[model samples]
Target chain A: MLYVELIAQGLIQGSIYALIALGLTLVYGLLRILHVAHAAFFTLGGYVGVVVANQTGSLAAAIVAAMIVAGLGGIVVFRLCYQPILHQPPFVPLIASIGLYIAAEELFRIVFGPSGLTYKYAFLQGEVELLGFLRFKTGELVVVFGSAAIIGVLSLLQTRTRIGVACQATVSDPQMAESFGISLSRVGDINFFVGSALAAFAGVMVSVLNNMVEPTMGSVPSYKALAIIVLGGLGSVRGTLVAALVLGVVESFGTIYLGHFLDRNAIAFAFLILVLMWRPQGLFARS
Target chain B: MLRLERFSCGYGLFRAVSELELEVPHGTITGLIGPNGAGKSSTLMCVAGHVNLLAGSIVFDELDIGGLPATERVRRGIAIAPEGRRLFKDLSVEDNLRVGGLIHPAGRFKADRDYVLSLFPRLGERLGSLAANLSGGEQQMLSIGRALMARPKLIMIDELSLGLMPKMVDLCYDALLRLKQDGMTILLVEQNTDRVLSVADHVCVLESGHAVWSGNAADARNDPTLAAAYLGLH
Candidate 1:
């Protein structure tokens, strides 16, 4: 029974990781920005969702508000800090992203205070038995379905729309896309906004599961998502999704069976090292 | 038709092209040739709106388009197949063509893609293949095909014969002339003066960012003294 429950929990956790990886992969693939500040935006979304829900007593409003805030923050960061560094080397923007990340984290801390906050809603906390040995909470089940829905919608948008086509072009070659009359800045800004919103959605899922939120919650997940991106293959969405699922299952089983005392981070690092040494081009490199 | 009057452009104050004046009339091939660093590319970049005009004006179809952005210029029927073929290497050949046709209205992309593919049958054969995998000559054909998808009124090709076998260069120029006969206005920038002079209606020679000579291709071809002086061969 414990083993089955652990597997279920691991799947749910993997879904959240996949959400984070989805956004990270989009921005990294298109704009080639490390965008470390995205993690802070993720934490901000959770806090915002809880605060909005607590104030309005409406889960829908809370989720909308969280996505909107994170999306707007993404636009601002892309326009003000990152876009100007398009012609510069990679290191400048990366350092700038770090500074922005720290600034956003501090700002979140100041606004909501240093401690964690909880959403005392019963809808999320409630759980039901699926079978004699299997049980799942409302939030956990919601995470699974909600993530699938979002991913499905995003894939559709990427494949079918004009903006999606332009985004693919920009990711493939910004200069060539420009020659084709596609505005790199506009596509890049929109992608950033969308990616951040997705990250925010993932944050809300995490908050519902843990029943609490803190400003620093994004740091670990950010590293994990980056690892997922590297493992999946840079600029490859499908690869990131697979990597996220694999990471979630491995980490969950590692924590339970191998003991929580083990440094699970070593798993990510070793995987990264192996990937870099074996296939520096990434596992499913498009070009 | 494209015309540049007293066009000066550069990086900051260091002038790359200074007070250059030139013209490519409607449905005619104009070849721009110069020695290395004689500002052939700088002039093309300025006309394409990739480089800012430091002074003077660029008039494309009688509109002052010098101040427009690169993408905006491209949208206004100005297309440049930049040096080195600047392809979106990760994208499939079809996607690259689709991107080139992005400025067109929604209903026209499929038709444009078909037309461009027909122009370069090699690209049609490899439509689903990644562009990075294409050979250099194939990549050049794809670049030209991609630019053709834009349906531009005027197309500027920089260094059309660079890093290609002599036979491939001949084939490319033949294709370019066919495009010209199909009513596409062309501004050909090349270091291979002999080939360009063979096909151009008019030839303009630039030396150190200034137009040193301009005349009919036949006149320039027959006058060795004039050709030698203008081409820096004397």
Candidate 2:
């Protein structure tokens, strides 16, 4: 019964991780930028959601408002800090992103103060029993189901839409895509907006699950996302999905079984190291 | 229909072509022939807006397109089948073609796609397969077909017959002729001088980024200096 409960918890937790990996993979696939500020956007989303939900007392509006604000923030970051130096070395944009991440984290500190916060909601606090041994919170169910639906939709969008195909083409070969009349810069901007939006949503989802929000909440999850991206393969959406779920389950078990020595958060890195040592290219990375 | 007057282009601090004056009149095949590193690809890429244009102008339909980006140039009716046939390896043949025509009206998608299928019937057969799954010859055909889907007035094909069987090359040249008859302008860069001379209306031979010779294909074929030195026509 405890095992099943842990597994359920891991599945819910993994959904949020998958969301972060999905954003990382999406932006990395197109722009090849590390985009550390994406994690900052995650923190931004939590703050935005917190304020909106508290003021209006609506979770739906909070998530919507968070997505919009973080999405626009993504576009602004892309235009200002990222796009101009795209022609530079890959490390150049990566370093700029790191700088942006630090600056944004500090801004959050100034605005929200140097402490943690959580949302207060009655509907989100209740729990429901599933099967004989599994009982999950309403918030946990939302995390699992919502992440699955969003990921499913994103997968469909990537394979079915014109912009999605264009993004894939650009990823494969930028020069050829350009010759074929695809604007490389334009595609990068759209991807940044999308990837950042996903991060924003994931941020709120994670907050909803824990009933806690903090400026530094994205810090640990962001590292876990990097690990998840590597585990699934650098730029593969399907890989990220599977890797995130497996990781979430593993972390949950590790917390229960190896809880004394290894914290639940630290398990992500431990698994990442194991996966990397075993498969250098990741589980789903193509040659 | 396309003109490059004193056009100079290259990577930073390295000029690939200098003071190059060239023109492809509307509805003509201008075969640009040269050895490796002779700037044939650079010139074609320059016209397609890939290589940086450090000097001069690229005038098309009385509009200067030198400063425009690659997609903007494509929007203005210019396309290129770049070197190495850089197809979207993960995408199906149909999806690759669709992406090529994204800038054009969605209504013409079927018409333009049908036109390309007519040109390369093999592509029609393999429309559902990933580009990476295709043979080298088939990939080349698909690359050209993708460029055609844009409905561009001028199409520049780099190394049109590179790394393909002779029969496949003949088929590609046949498509080129058919395209020419349809009133399309072509700037074809090739190493196969004899094959280029066989059908090209005009020819430009580059040596060390300079236009060493430019004239009607017949004159180029008869010129003993060019025949033995560059074209190997003898």
Candidate 3:
């Protein structure tokens, strides 16, 4: 029963990780940029979600507001920051992303206060009994089921729609896509919007689950997502998902079993190093 | 019809084509034939808005399109099947075509796809397969077919026969001829001088980024000095 509870906790955490990592994977897949600043969007979403929920006292409104803010912010960042340096070396934009992320963290501290913000209203606060004996938080259920639904919709959009096909073409061959009239800029805009929105959603969920939102809240997940993407294989969405879930489970188990020797994050990184050493191409990467 | 007047295009600090004047009439095939480094591909890329046009104007159907982006150029009815057949390798053949027709309404997709399938029936059989899985010839065919999905009034083909089997080349050329008969303007850059001469209504022979000779196909074929000197034909 304890193992089952731990497994459930791991999966819930993994679902949130998957949400954050998907954004990183999408941006990396489209532009080959590491997008470290994605964490800023996540932080911004948490702030937006908290402020809106506090003011209106509605969770749905908070989520919607957070998504809009983060999605549009992503487009602005892509246009003003990443687009200009895209023609340069890959590291140029990556460094810019890191710089932007640091700047955003500092800005958030200045604006939102260095201390942190807490949810004013109690939402998804109760625990539900599941499968006759097990217990689960309503927030955990929402995180798992919500993340799965969003990922499902995203996959469907990529596979079933015209814009999705155009995006895929642009990803595979930008110049060729341009020759066929698919604008690379448009594709970049859409990718950044979608990816950033997902990150923001994760931020809101995390804030709700933890009942806290702070400037430094995005820092851990940012690096964790980076590790997950690299471990899953950069630019591979499905790999990122699997890696996120696996890392979540490992961390959940390791926090109890291996806490005496190493920290949870250390365990995740160690796992990444092992996996990379074994299959440098990544678990799901096509050789 | 498409007209390039004093067109100069190149990569940054490196001129690939300079002050090249050329014209492709409607319902005709114009062949630009040259040896390696003769700016054949560069000329086509410039017209397609892929390469930078340093000077002069690209007039397509009386619209000055020199400053337009590649996507706008496609909307104005110009498309290209570029060198190396740069298809979306992860996408299915049908998806590649769908992306090509992105500017059009979704309602028009079926007709455009059907038209492309008619041109390259082999694509119909492998629409479900990924682009990377196709053979070289099929890839080339799909590349051309993808461009056709845009329903362009003018199509520019770079290295139409390069890396293609003779049988595949013949099939591609046959499709080009059919496109011409259907009143589509074609600007083709080819290394196969003989094939170009046989099919091209007009021919321009480029050498070192300059037009060495420009004339009708009959005139080019009849001029033994021009043929032997530039066309490498005795």
- Which candidate has the highest lDDT of all? 3
Candidate 2 clash pair list: none
Question: Please, what are the lDDT tens digits per residue for candidate 3 over residues B22-137?
Answer: 99999899999989899999998888888999999999999899999988899999989998889899999989889888888999999989988888898899999999999999
DockQ top scorer: 3
Return the top candidate by TM-score. Answer: 2
TM-score of 1: 0.88
lDDT of 3 by residue, A166-193 (tens): 8888889888888778878889989988
Greater-TM-score candidate between 1 and 2: 2
Which residue window of length 10 is worst by lDDT in model 1 chain B?
A: B225-234
**Which ranges in model 2 have alpha carbons more than 4 Å from their true place?**
A1-3
State which docking tier applies to candidate 3: high
Which residue ranges in model 1 land beyond 4 Å of their true spot? A1-11, A55-61, A85-89, A124-135, A263-287, B12-14, B163-171, B207-210, B226-234
Q: Candidate 1's residue-wise lDDT over B127-208, tens digit each?
A: 8888889988788888888888899999999899899888778778888888888999999999888888889999888889
lDDT of 1 at A48: 87
Candidate 3 Cα outliers beyond 4 Å, as residue runs: A1-3
Q: What TM-score does each of the candidates earn?
A: 0.88, 0.97, 0.96
